[model samples]
Each structure stands twice: as C-alpha cells, then as structure tokens.
Target: MVEGETIDTASLDGYVPFDSERQQAYIDAGYWRNITFHDVVDRHAEEIPDYTALVGPHRELTYAELAANSRRIAAYFVGELGLRPNERVVLQLPNCTEFLEAFVACSRVGVIPVMVLPRHRSAEANHVVDLTDARAYVVDYGRYSSGFDFVGLADDVRSSHESLEHLIAVTDGETSSVDGCDAFAEMRDERWVDKYGDEVSKTDVDPSKPGVMLLSGGTTGLPKAIPRTHNEYVFQWERMADAADVRDDWVAFPGVPIGHNASLNCIVGAALWAGATVAVEPELKPDALMAFIERVGGNYTLPMPTQILDILEHPDLDQYDLSSLEVLVSGGQKVPPRVVEEAVDRWNVGFCNIFGMAEGPLICTRPGDDVKVQANTVGRPIAPEADEIRIVETDRETEVPPGEAGELAVRGPGYFTGYFRNEKENTENFSDDGWFFTEDVLARRDDGNLEVYGRIKDTIIRGGENIYAPGIEDELVEHSKIANAALIGMPDDRLGERPAAFVELTDDATELPLKDVSSFLEERGIAVFKRPEYLEILESLPRTEVGKIEKQALKDRIVDAESK
Candidate 1:
C-alpha cells in the first residue's frame, strides 16, 4: 500500500479523473522530485538563508536560524541520547517555536514524530504514549492549567511503557533550569554542526519510507496510528497547495495547530514547498490570532468556523489591520454558509471551504471554482490519483445521483499507505474493491460543485428517519447569537436515537429567544424532521485533538446529566 509501490508511473497518467489535465504539471515536476521534508528544509536554509521562515509574538526563527537550531536538536537526538530512525518520538506541546524545531529536526534525521495535542491530559497522554511505545516524550514544563508537570508526566509514561526512556523538558534549567531531566537549552546548543547532514541534502531520501505517525482521535477505538512517508507527503502538499492557490510570495497564517494535517499539510509545507513565508499563530482565539497576523504581515489565513465567528462578533475586531489577508481558508469542521457569508459580506473576504480527513480525500477550493462554490461548496477531488472518489448510495453500494447524499469512498496517491502496522483495521477501513470509505456524506451539485452533508456515522436515526447533523448545525450557526453548534443523537425511548443540538453561544447570546433558532431554520426551508428535539447550551462544545466538535463528548455529558 506504500505510495511508491502501489502507484506506478503508468497508472498516474489518468489518475485524477475528477481533476483537470492541468494538474499533471505538478506530478510531472514532482514525480521524481523525490525529496524528504528535511531535504526541503536544508535547501531552504542554504537558498533563502536570510528569509524569515517562521514569525510569532514569542520568537522569530529564520530559515538558516531554524535549520541551525534543528541541527543541534537533531545531534542531541541522535548522538548523546541515541535516538534512531523508525522510532517514535511523542511531541506534546502547543503551537510554538519549539514544536517547529523538534518536528523539523526529527524529519531531518528520520525519527518518527507523533504529534501529541496539548489538550491531552496525563491519562490520555499516557494512553497514546503507551500504545505508540514511544522512546521519548517532549513537552513544555510550564504550560496551560492542570499544573501539567513535565517531570511527572515523564515518570508516568516510563512506568506505563517499558520502552519509554527519555523525557526532555523544554524551558527551565540551572544556568538555564531543571534538575534530573535534560535541559532544552543543552539541545539548542549553537556550537553543534551537522553530522547526518547528507540525510537532509540527499535526493535519495526515501519518500516511501515512514516519516510521520498521525494518530486517529480514538473516535471508534483507541486512536490508530497512520504513518505517512516522504513521497505521499509530497503528493499531499502539491494537491493542498494547488487547492489553496499558493504562490511563491504568499504568506500563510496557520490558526490550526501545526502538528495536525490542516496546518502541517497545507500551511507549513505549502509555505516551504512553494517558497513562501508562514506566520504561526499560537491559539485559535480571535484577538490573539489576528494580533499575530498583524505582526507577521500575513496574506493568507486558515481559521476554523468558530474562530471566524469569534472575529465576526468580536467587539474590537474592527481595530485589527487585516487588509494584508488576501485569502481565508477554513477547514477541519463543517462551515455554516451564513457565518461565512456574513464574514465575506462584511469583512470583504472570500471563504475557501476545504473538507477531508487525515486518512483520505483532501477536497478544497481551486482557482477555477466559482465564488459561490468557493464559499459554499467543500470542493472536488484534488489528487492526481482518484480511482474511486464519490458520494454513493448507502443502502445499495450504488453511486448516487449527482445531487444525492451518500458515503464518500476514495483511493489515490495522497491517501495514506495504511494505518501503521494495523492489518485488520486497514482491511476494514478500505473497501474490498480498494476505495477508502470516508464515512462522510456529500452531495454533488448540478454545477459540478461538492457540498458536504455531514458524517454518515453522525447521522441521527430519529424514529427511523435519518437526520444529517451538518444540515441542522449549518442553520443553527446562521443566527447572530450562536457561535458554534453540534448535533448528536441521544437515545429516545420511542425513537432509536433523537437529534440533540449542543450549542456554544456568543457574548451577546442572552438577548436571543429560544424560538429564534427554530424560526430561522424553518424560514430557510430546513425540514422539521431535521430540527433538534433538545438543545443544550454550554460555554463551549468539547473538541477532539484536531479541534473538530466532539459530538461523542456531548453525548456523554447528556447521559451524565440524565443519570443525575
């Protein structure tokens, strides 16, 4: 299932059936362009030595500076600490300069870096660290609430997994901070020179070899590991960059965490791959992100739906200087068209609706897509290989009509090789015929545009009638009072599972009446059956590691509340 092995040169000629023939230019150029992410970094360091690679409020690292620091870190990882290729190095830090250093360093030296989201507490962290059999774990000693101690977490990981040995603490040492644990400053040594430097410069760097281990959010079970190689990553980046219309001078403001595919695949790599500047914002909070964007002189921004709503509703949003932001790319959640419409109409910016998951298709807005499609539609397949990519009938295994909603199954060059070493799960995830079932429902509009319906798994069977959640949530976000909305099915004694709307409200939410939501949806012609039977208001809806609305968490909260 490796990209190099599975996808032959001949098979790729007609690979992208859904895409225009113009996309062949990218593959023709990158086909044998075979360079690891590390190779790109090393090339950039030498070529664009003085250019600012990353800029943030906390620190600024140039291409040469970031590469130098990463080399020192790579030395510590390989020389003193004895890290090896194919070994798992768990990175559990928020968006910061350190994450970039460690992640790029690992890629350079070929040690597999598994991204550990900052939201994971000790228990959840331990579960993933244990499952991955990670040799080392990296974290910020003093970060966030919960008094999340790096030393304590390290000890817990060591106890849980016999393979765990190193626990590198960033920030705080003697002349620098920390007692027993290794100081991050020691690894950041300036004197260290490149040793496995060929690993970075060599064109022979195996793109088929495993490079990153992206963890599933444990939605169905404990998160399964998916290994992405260098070549597959190249394909992913080309497709994403193509979709985003990334130019050499384009600057990207990554609102999503860099570790996740949204930022890493599109923002980080797109910048490097296209020779553009990237502004790494710390949090998705509206003010902070826009402030960071102001400082970095950004041209492009990729914010989620809620983050957009926050900006649209922010009291002092008008104060920020966002005239430099030429493009706004939104993904990782369903975008309510109205929220996007308001932002576009008011802020004078067009919305790019990107839809896809880590394990499969990456549908995003392209240059040729109409303004309505760019704002309203998710998009068509952007891959050079798409043997099967469509919304098909769930009841009969038949391809649904263009406008009908059904499951999305696809297989292409950008698709993951397979889940990391999970044979049984891999067999089940992909169909026997070979298409990777996305478990998402989508509709192909009459104009050849694609609109995401909702998660097929998230479908609420209310009294045997299926109510897709995204359609309902989309209408819910249209109201001025609502910030974010998620609909989850709850067990009804009469109906198998009834749709429940879990909502997060804006600051001015107090004034809106309950009927306002229902009336708005009804006027828009949203079916009565799709209307939620219950509405739960919260400060915020729980999110997965990828920042997706955690409907399962809402379901648990409802059950817990009902039990009490």
Candidate 2:
C-alpha cells in the first residue's frame, strides 16, 4: 500500500505543521486525540447503532447505515457539489459501497479525499489532478474488468483538468446521467436526503486539520502527497486498532486498496475506529477472496504477501469455509516465512506482520507475536510511545550499531507533516530534526523485532504494488526505441516482484519485445500494474563508477540467470 501524490487547502496555512514542540508532544502523548473522522462516524452512530458497519458487494451498512451514508455523502458534497470546507475531491472509487460512501463523505464534509487508484489512468489521473487542485473527479460507473474506462476515465480526467469542476459518478443502476457525471444516485435521494441531510454540523470539524491525502509510493516522479491529519489519523487508526487485536466483534477483510495507506491506516481505519465489520470485495481474487470469506463471516484480513501466495495456492484450497479466518495481515513486500508458516499451520489463522508507509511508518506484527516472531519480525512500534525509531547511518544523524542494518528512521505521532506541496519532496524526505527517512533497510532483533533488510530506495514491490524505479525508468527513456532504462525487481513466486525492463537500444534499434514493452507502457498511461514483466536487451546499463545505474549489477543478472 505504498501509493503517492499530494496537495490541499482548508488552511492550516496548507499544512506541514508539527512544530509546537512537536505538536505538544503529540498532545501530551494521548497521541493527539482531538477526534474527527466525522468524530468516528458520529460516535459509532450513537454507539453501535445496530452494529454491522458496511459489507459491500451489494449491501448491509448499519452503524446507522454507516452514519446515514456518511451524512448523505456529506450533503452531496456541500449541498450538491458546491463543496467547501477545505475542498479537494478526486477519490477514484472501487471497493464499493461507494468506496465507503465516498470515504466517509470526505470526512463528513471538510472534503479532502484525493486518493487516486482504481488503477489510475490518464497519467495517474492527470497527476492527481495536477496535484490536488482537485475540485471533484470521483468515478466508478462502467468499464474496469480491464476494459478500462472508469466512466471514460473520469471523462478523460475532466477534459484535462479545468480545475476539474465536479464529475462524480459511482453507480450500479439507473440514476441516469452517465457522461455529464454527478450521480452517486443523487446522494441517496430522500429528496437529496431531505435537503442536505443536516448538512454536517458540529462546527465543521478540525481535528488538527489535513484528514486524508496519502499517495507517496515515491522515489522519483508522479506520486507525492501524503497529508493524513485528523489528529494524525486518529493516532494511526486507534493505535493500529490496539495493535491488531481489533475487536468490537471484528470482521474486517480489507483485501487492500479501499484507498490504501494500508487500507486506510491498517484495515479500514482500524475497522471504522474499532466498531469493526468492514468486508468489501471487488477484486484481489483468490477464488473471489475465498468466496468473500465464505460469504462474509470474514473474521479479519489484510493479504499482501502476494495475497498470501494467492490464498495458499488456490487449487480450490479445500473448497472454502476458511473457518472464519481470525487474523492474517501480511503487507506490501518482504514476507515469506512460509507465508507465515502456512497461514498459521492452516486455519488456526493468526499470521500477522505489516510495515506501512505513505509518509508515515506503521510497522505491525502484534496479535500475540511469536510464530517465529510472526515469521521473522516486523513487530513493535505500533506507536511504541508515539514513535521515534532510528537505526540511521548514511549519516542522517549516525546511530546504527546494535545488531545494525540502518535506514528506517521515523519520528512521529504516526509520521507525516511534510510532502504536500513538494518543496523538493519536503526537503528530500525530511530530517533536519524531524526524521521520516525510511529508505527502509531495517534490522533490530535482540527481541525488539524489526528485521526486513532491503531498500535504500529504488522500489519495485510488485504484487503489493509500490513500483517506483525512476517512474518506470522515466517512461523507459521516452521509448522511441529506448536508449537507456533499467527498472528491475524480478523474483516472483507469484508477484512478490515482477517489473524487469533493462533496455538500451536506439541507434536504429533492433529488437525489444515483451509485447513492445507492454504496448509502450499501455500507451504511456502506465499503471497496468506499472507494466514491464521482463524485457532485457541492454548492451550498456551496468554503470556505477559514478554513473550509478548498476542496480546491484542488474540484480546480479537476475541472480545469475536464476542459477542456471
């Protein structure tokens, strides 16, 4: 869940705060709990209003119909799209129930959404609507069983952004209008929820501003905006739903990308701030997510070790009835400890291990850790006293010694108060006394957990989709038969990595297949899971005597041609 892009408004002077003695030491260590995510869906819709909060693939909402469908889509985004409060739309919907009623109706009307990924088209949705000047783009009305067309890619990103000016969509039946957009079934019409469903009162809301922007799977271009505020995502989804014990009669499921950031701060913002029950299922198919967890008794999930090796190699893996799961976790990359010891030796299911980042550092592995330290550590710091974690050494202040590996960094009330309007990636990824670094690498172990030693930036990650490699090697040397490009990441026991480009040609080029580099990165709109699944033609790439590119000598020539 390493996505990227950024921008914003609702004035906290457009943010990058955290300095009043690091925001009152994260509000005196109560981890800044000033509330607001529509005050946890209006205090669980007045305390568990008939529980079952959201199931999707058709229906089942309660928590008073997910807080009255997020206050009737926050009164159709401020009384029929006049949208204000800090306006900045762009959602790009998909794990439907209108993507959690337009992400909790853009946090009950202080609109800031900007998520971007139903496999983003139109050059990463017109570079996140030219970095969040977004005044509505929404989507989800037709084609995407790879027929592509998300409402004709949000009308070609609203005819190449005219400050976008509303487009909406999200429908399944006759709410009519499809091309001129605006029809999330007319905001659940009860005559527009009786004229703006009490327009989202409680003094508009501030929970220390920002409330959702996240994108940043960045290492080079097109992805850089990780805002995340509402009191730092309610202290990172209620301390990662109390470090994955997540109960309010848990059900979860979040098979990733319900606007990611590890499915919103680890499983639908910790199952809607722990009132639990999320479910959703539009695609991440392991026999349709084990038939939507044997038809919805889900019992928690997270899946991303190549979807736990495609649901432990589904050859109809014992024809469903996953014994109501009860915890699985896994995250972006680095996770094979036998897929956490064969999904906890089959069915007693506990699994675990997370490690996040949009611009924050979530790190998990809890629910009673040891299955070999939840298959080789990742645990610890689900706010270990409001995050500090260092390790260091390529001099981001030196430290690195105790069983060393380096790079991780951190520093936070769930880290992020930078990179919104770039300022050169907020000064090359923050650290003049603020930290964030995370070019990964890790290693901590003497029982304090950590481990995963890899990345000092030049990401790839594949099936859990990070894919940076110089933004597809700057669109593979702008292709005219390429003259230099590199990409990388090959080993894929089911997508734990895939890309592999390499290039070099152009001098009356010769050959370059992998379907002409996946139809020239799908006509340059890119994201068909960031294209390039193998295409090595290089007569020159391995550089570094100062020229750089020797990507570990092209990953030791795909590990010496897969050991012959």
Candidate 3:
C-alpha cells in the first residue's frame, strides 16, 4: 500500500509541517486522492502556475511554463518518438535544466524513467541501456570532464544499443554541438512547445503503474533494477515532506546527484511534493550554494556528510552569512561528531539526521528534536507508523532487542513493490508476509533510536564471526587524528577474511602510518581483536557518482593491489 493517502486537502501554498497526529488527520482527509508522482507537479502547475518551479544556471521555468515545455517534450515522445506507456527511457546527464524538463515530461506521459548517473562510463551505461531495452535516451553529449569526450561516448551508446531509438542532447549554454543526435534546440525549432504543450492528458494513468526504475548499488553483486509504482514514491514524498517541515515557503538545497534515490525521493521530490522550491542549480561549489542560500533566504540544506565536513572546514567559512539556514540534515554517510557538534552549538540551527534508502521508508529528525538527540541517533520511526519497521536478527526476519544489530525490513505505504522484470529478485527481496526486505543492517540505540549499521551485503565474515563495517568506522571517526575511514574485509588464508582501513586525512595533518593508527585504537577501548590489520592512507577515497564512498571500487582496488 502506498503510504501517501491524502495527508491534507488544504491548499498546498499554506501547507507547513505537521505533527504525527495532525499528519494522520490530514491523511485521514483526501489530500492525496487520485495523486501520483506526476500529480504533484500537475497540481502545482494549476495551484501556483506563475511560481518559479525550476531554476537552472542557464534557464528558469515557471510551473506553468515547465508544464508547457514538458508537454512539448511529452508530445515529441508520444507522437514523434512513439514511446509507449510503461516503456523505459534512460536519462543520463549532469545537473541541468533540460534533464529535469525531459524527466518531468516522461512522468507526464506515463513513461517509466531510469536515471543512470552521468558519471557512468560508456560501458556501464551501455550495459544498463541494453538491459532495460531503453526506447530513448537523454544525454549531455558535448560535456567535457577529465578531458573525456562525452559526445563520443553518447555516439557509441546510440550505435551499440539496438532499441535505443532517440538520443536527446541537453546542451550547457554552449553553441558547440554533437552530430547525429537530436539537440534540445530542435524541439523549440519544431514548435514542440506549442505542439506538445497539454497535448497529452492524464486520462490513462492508474497511479499503480510502474513509474521509475532505480538500480541498486550492486555492492554485493550485480546491480538490481528496483521498480517503483508512481503512487509508492508519491506517498513517500507527501508523508516525508509533511514530517520534514517541507512547505511552499521553504527553499531547499540538495547538493547530491539528483539521480540518486536519496536526493530525488526524499529531499528534492519531497520538497516539490509540498510546493516548495529547490535552489536553481544544485549548488556544488560551497561559495555558490552559500550565495543561493543568502539570495533566497534558504532555510534547509541536506548535504552529504563529507560535503558538510568540507563546508565546516572551508577556510572562508566565517565569511559566508548563512543566517538564512534553519535546518541542516546529514546522511549518505555518517556525520563526523565534531562536524555535528559545531553545526548545532556554533551555528544554532536544527542539525538533523536523515536515514533513508531506495527500497525503504525514511526517518528524519523533526523540528523540535534537541541537538544532542539529533546528533546521537539517526532518528526514530517516521509516522503514520502504519508501516512495519523492524530490525530482525540474522537468521530470521524477527524483531531484535535494543542495542542488538540486525538487518532492517520495512512494510509501509512508501515501500517499493518489486524490481523491474526480475521475478528472481522479487522472490529474494519480498517475504511471504508481504514485507519488503531492505537488506540494510541497523541497530536500535539505548535511547530507542536507530543507527544504520551499513549494508548487510558488505558485512565481513572472518573466522566464522561477522563484523559490521560501520562499528569500526564510527570508532575510527572518534579517533582525534582520523578524518574519514572505510573498513573493507580483505581475504586472509587462515582466518578466511580480515579488515582493512582506508583513511582520508585532513589537508594539513601529518601522515599516520598503519602501526601508529593501530596503536591509537589500542590505547582506546577497541580490543586488539577488532583492530584493522592493514591501513592504507592515500590522497582521497573514490566516491560513487552520488558522492558515496564506493566501497566496491575500493575493495576491487585493494584486491588488485594485493594481487600485484
């Protein structure tokens, strides 16, 4: 059951954060009747037609105008391109206005969209596109990074995929172009805005049809394509938005890659679901983000943990007047205690924790949570606690005791139905009782709050004993000399496996070798048995496209290095 069942029938413009009871009261009403992900923007298009819904570095589209552009793109899709309902389209691009335009257009047309990270190698996108049998694709063909020719890669994908019929190139304010691709400019030239605007109506939408496909991190093995019905994610956004104080008057800054589930589902999607505005472009540069925040009197920012650390450590941190910020959320990684400490004690803002994932419900700190509580635990369960949120022991999916680590499984209105076209995956992920297995391991803290304990698939089994990486990681962060650490199990002949520590240090800190780091941990309460055997410190850790430390990548590297 999709959880977002009419939380409020009141005007969205006046909508503000509501407590659990009021939230349920609103839910008891029909605020969400006949609504889906597409419905959010459609309602906004009618309610606040003239308001700015999207702002990019190059273009700004009002709600009505966005709808107009989306209609045109949708028409191009349905009429010219002949994209069918529930058919898949691949959108791979950096944070750009055109990506949003095309994505929204797909939603309006009832086409399922699969967002591939723009940083994907041509080979990766090729594999995904082939697997999905994508009907069309959106790319930033002329983009250049690391001096690689994006156009060349795009061309290769178009040639390689048999079902890939259309390639729409979204440009970045430059005239230079890629040949053999349909440019975004062509749509305007073809009067696509006038031709497609409102051309397709929502006559056939079921609200239960699959709308988006999110690929898992493939941490344990191959990436699985998780398909979500429109209503499932819509319910997630509506409830989470109401809980997180998302509203029309609020301005949110999401610096993470929009392609990630955390950013799209919880942060930006929730914001838009409530008629709130996100910053024009996702501000990556701290200075630019600060400027945008100052410009809009922005109240909310939910940066990745490392990003927040960078912001806190910036030499010019004192120069920015961020008085506009009312709340800060840290997730996708653990927030350094010192960073969390300063964010609240010094900044005097609501520093909160957001624990979330693609296949599960989200938990975020409410407005009234104290700084200490917010810093200590990720959060309590989100309400309309109609959903089943439980931490189960290893062998079976039954509830666990406090302070005991177990895998998390949730059954709720916001949970996904199944993975796309993968019955085998569905069989493994869902239980006979109807709960979706999130596969994320977590622990209930002493205070009855939950702290995510890392992926169950990433767990280390050494000599028949299981080790959770996050436990060691949190302890590693507590070390005064350490900046950030990731523990990955390396193969050991006798023990079967052992742990390794990969540390990324502060800019100016002297290099601490493995021996010294081990000594520091031993001097603390960490037992010798738990200490990492091999510690490697390099310049920086490699991150996924969305800024998450790609442990798989790191593990692969470690394996390669050891073998060499």
Candidate 4:
C-alpha cells in the first residue's frame, strides 16, 4: 500500500521524489511533516506579530509585516502577473530584507524560486533561465553596488529564453527606469493586497511539491539544478536548528550571499525556523560585517573560515563591540585549526564546523562539542536516523571500517532524491539501491566524528603513496608563518604527481622557503610522502564566491608557470 501522501512526480517536471517505501519510512520515523515553508512563517506571524523577523542595514521588519508583505507580493504574482502554481522565477538578488520577502512570497503562492547568485553573469543567468524555463526574472537593480547592469542582463536573458514572460526589478526610487519591467513596490503595495487578498488566501500549495531549486556547486562543470520539496527542505533546516541549538532570542548573521545553500539553509532557514531574527548586510568586509553584527546585536553567525581569518586579522578588530557574538559557525572548506583556536580564545564564542551540500546531508559540530572536535572534525550527522552516513571504497561496493578514509555516500531523509533534469548524472552519482555518492573523502573516528580529507579527485599519488591534499593543507596552516594554505597535485614525470603548496603568509611573517615547509611537516609527524615538495607564496588564493579554494585555477596557473 502507498504510504502517507503519494507525490505525483509527473507534476514536478524534473524533480524526483521519495519512493513509496522511503516515504513510509520517513513518515513513520516522524521525519517527513506535511507542511509548506510559508506555514511556518504564518504560524510565527500569528504567535508573534510584533516580533522582529528580519533586520537589514536599511530597515527592520516584524513577523506580521513580513507575512503581510509576502502575502501582498504573492497576490500580485498570481492575481496581477498571472503566474500559476509551480511556475518558476529566476530570483537574483543580494542579501536584504526583500530577498526574504520574495523567497517567502514564492513559497506562499506555490511558485518555485530559482535562486541565482548576484555574481552570476549573463552566461550563468541565461543557463539557469533556459534550464528552468522560468516565467519571471526578479532582480535588485537599484543600487548598482557591483556597478554591473543587472537590468541589462535580465533583458538579455528575457530575449534569449522564450519562456521568460515578465521582468520585475526592485528599486529604491519611486519609479522603475527599465522598460517592460514592473516595479517591486507594485507587488507589495498595501492596496494590491487589499484587492486580491481573498483570492490569494484561497490558493492551495502542496507540501509535497517542489519549493526551491538550488544550483549545484560541483567543480568540474556547469551547475545542475537541485530540486527540494517543501517537506524535505523544511526537515533539513529544522534538523539544523536542533543541531546548532538555535534559540528564538538569538540574532543570526550569514556573511555570504543568500543564494548559497549554506546561507539559505543554515543561517536563514534554521534561524527563522527557531523564530530567531536574521541580520542582513550586503557588505562582507571585516569592519562592515563587525559593525553590522554589533548594530543588530547578532549573537550567531555563519561565515566562511577565510572571512573569520580576515576578521581576526583586521587591525581594528579590538575596537568593534563584537561581544554580542555567541557563536561563530563556518563551513564549505576545511577550517584551519588555528582559526578555530583563535576564535574561541579571543571571542570566547562557540565555533561550529558544518559539512553540507545543496543536495542535502548536513553534519555539524554542536554548541558544546569539544574544541578539538570542532577544530579537527565535522561532527556527527545532525539526524543520525534520517541522515545515514557511510564511508565506502572506490568500487562503491564495500563499506570502509572506521579510521580509514573513503568516499562519503549517504541515503536517507536528509538527502535529495536526484539532480533535476539530469538523468545521466542521476544514474552516475546514485547507486542502484539508492545511495548518493558525495565524491568527498572522509574518515569516521571511533568517537563518531568525521574527518574530511577533501575531494576524492584532489588526492595526490607520489611514488605509489596516496596522499590527501586537505590533510597536508591543514597541517601547513598550523605553521606560525602561514596564514592560509592550499595543496594541489602538480604534474611530475618521476612520480605520477607531486603535491605543491600555495601559501599566504601571516601579517608579521616574511618569506617561507620549501625547506621550512617540509621541515615543519616533518616535525609535526606528517608522513614523508604527504609533505609538499614545492612552495609558492601568493598574496591570496583564488576562491569561489562562497570562499572555497579554486584549485582548478591554481592548477592551471602552476601548469603555465612550469611550462614557462
């Protein structure tokens, strides 16, 4: 017999849903709750209308106001623009209260928002628009903070993608300058809601339907769309809220673009799930971030480790009243132990290391976890029963015993069923039975913590010895002179490939030679084969928008430099 609600996958377009057996298991285990994203907001609005839901550099919004604005915009989407349920819209905007408004508004009307990063150029935007067949393109075009014409980009996408029907631009000015674009204010105007409030209130959004589409961040190719149903997405963030011990009175600051999966799920979703307030700041520089946190009384934040290092390195760090910060959370890449150490020592705040992906699977260090665990491991799965973690051999047939590194494979309530519209990738990345091969290398400790060894493709083989790059990079950053480190396997004729170190020195340090790096690892008892053979001092490492090291860029640079 079918269990609980049967998801009609045909209606989802390219979105894959849990099968009958898996659906029953999740529902029986109490993991799958039939609830839409907006239900949570409406609940909070009714319970705490006067409570602050969101705060930005420009304005503050209470839960009642937030819900009212979302309902208003949602009414405009359906009643005025004629957007139907399940229709897709490309939402490209920076961090602000309006981003939340637009996101929840999409949820309220059962429209799916295709989250597009602010840095996405016409190439990326066009790719998303074409893939999703989005009917509307929403962008924040007022500030010109990045000095790029987002309106022009929208026009270019609308011209090429035949499915795009409407252009919505958010501007501070009373009127919109762009032709064929609607002002955002029209959608949220009080009068519009008063007219169509009854019609929007009667709309029914299925909890089992797709809520949002997150772009994949795979290293090799163009990003694929990751479809998350409302039930699963809600479950994912609620687990995060529980794991991080989020309190309703807390203020959350996410020092990354809201489009990133980590920022969306961890900071925004989890915080709001617990009825906490989210603090938004478009500027991510150290001083700006610190001042924003202080101004908003932000107690919890998730910034990439590099951002934390930058904050620690800032000359005016001591001047900022960051005493309100209670927890500093970081993820996406291996956080240096020194960074963790300094944060705890200086700020007296809890530091949590999280391991997650757009396709689900959230593992995080809790608030009271041992400092060594926080520094060295990305703690146990947040929901042990729901998020089943495994370390499997290269063949993907057998599980590796604890303490041995292998590919991380997961299959459970917390993982996405498959990538949207990519049948080849779906078959290749998932097993016949169901596991999603994460492609990341990890080793489980006896104590239940998991140590990340970086990506499986990043392994270096020197004279038949398999060496993980992240392990060496982790050790390299512990050196007094090194501020940041990235390890790449450089081409070598003698040994298939040799590990090379790309390092950024600390503020007070000078030059560090290859011999010094090798000797430091030797003293640290790192395996001789894992030592970096060559060293290159760089002013800064190339990174993605989310702060992950761009190793491919470094590899290309090293190859060209070696050839020259």
The full ranking of all candidates by lDDT, starting with the best, is 4, 2, 1, 3
Residue-level lDDT of model 1, residues 364-407, one tens digit each, is: 77645566677689877766354247667874368898888888
* Deviation in Å, model 2, residue 181 alpha carbon: 30
- Each prediction's TM-score against the native? 0.86, 0.32, 0.88, 0.96
> How good is model 1 by TM-score?
0.86
What global local distance difference test value does model 3 have?
A: 0.71
Off by over 4 Å in 4: 1-8, 218-220
What is the C-alpha lDDT profile of model 2 across 1-564, one tens digit per residue?
Answer: 011212234353445777778878778867887877877877988988998888877778888877777777787677777776666888877676777777777887677787887765788788877877888887777522434667787777778778888887766665466758788767766565577665555335566778778787532357777778788888888888888878988789778667778777788888889898887887766788888889888888887765666577667889788898888887665565656877888887776687787777888788676798887777888878768888887777887876677688888877887877777767876868888787777768777888765576666788786766654675676677876677778888887888788878876888878887788789878888888878889778765211235576787889899999
lDDT of 3 by residue, 21-102 (tens): 5335435654334466656887889999988777666667777777777777777787678776667798876666676677
lDDT for 97 (candidate 2): 72
Off by over 4 Å in 1: 1-32, 143-147, 172-177, 190-205, 218-221, 367-369, 384-388, 395-397, 479-483, 504-520, 537-540, 543-547
Off by over 4 Å in 3: 1-32, 142-148, 172-178, 188-199, 218-222, 282-288, 513-515
Root-mean-square deviation of every model: 5.6, 23.1, 6.6, 2.8
> Model 1 scores what on Cα lDDT?
0.71
* Predicted structure with the largest lDDT when compared to the true one: 4
| Most TM-score-accurate candidate | 4
TM-score of 4: 0.96
